[model samples]
Target: MQAKEELQTHARSSPAVFGYPRGRDRRGLRFVISVSLQLDSQGCLRRLQSTGHAVGPQGGNTVCAAATALMRSASRALADHSSIVISGHAPREGVLEIEVLQCGAEYHAYLRGVTDVLLRGLKDLALDEPSEVTIRQS
Candidate 1:
């Protein structure tokens, strides 16, 4: 089956997992940010999209900074893999969309780890803001 078809099937069968959660923390702070990731068969990351603004009295700069760093790091890591096709866009404020197509086998582990780390960091950031991040099999 094709990648798109596989994703559709996976989506239908599996429930979406939380990359981050939408609810209140122990401190009773409610969060509203969310990030969702979809991985294709063979364990390759296919897409990552995030929405919601950074919260805090500090401003949105920190969230933007984190997002920028994550994107840069991911981009650089994938740079050596000519087989992978990556596309990203940050249109409007507090929105990020990144997609990776045709990830080669040799770089699969590295790319997956990179995304995992990025999500972990985003989770940490979500503690203060309303952040939710999730990874799902495609």
Candidate 2:
């Protein structure tokens, strides 16, 4: 009974903390994929972190696959640029983290372009799959 009350309190305070919105009963939500983006002072993406899994039926989750692909593609693209110093790794399954340590001024445009595409793709995905994906940009 105490645990149930605690869960109810938590749900009321921050429903999305468990991938369900306030006033909505938790139903039909298999999982949630959270993506976080950190921007630099110049408004360029400096860090990216994605964690969680959107589990679909029959063990096939297209949302998770798509999101992971997009993040990996962006990280690979950034790593290819000589003027950009980036570090990225997948510490475990369904988790990815990338950080841009340094970037030359001349390559700012390129960096912006790549990050813009990544952000746009992620935002679009979130829009299409709101229940399965959540994004937080800082």
What is the Cα-based lDDT of residue 64 in candidate 2?
Answer: 73
The global C-alpha lDDT for each of the candidates, from Candidate 1 onward, is: 0.57, 0.78
lDDT of 2 by residue, 2-104 (tens): 9978754653343355455542325533367789999977678899988776744323557777888889998999899899999989877667899999889
Residue pairs of candidate 1 with colliding backbone atoms: 19-133, 19-134, 20-132, 20-133, 31-130, 32-130, 33-130
lDDT of 1 by residue, 1-138 (tens): 698786545332211231234543233333334667676664555787766543332242455467557755776677567866688887755567888866776767878787777767766665654333332334
Model 1 TM-score, 2 decimals: 0.56
Per-prediction RMSD in angstroms? 15.6, 9.9
Instruction: Give per-residue lDDT, candidate 1, residue 82.
Output: 86
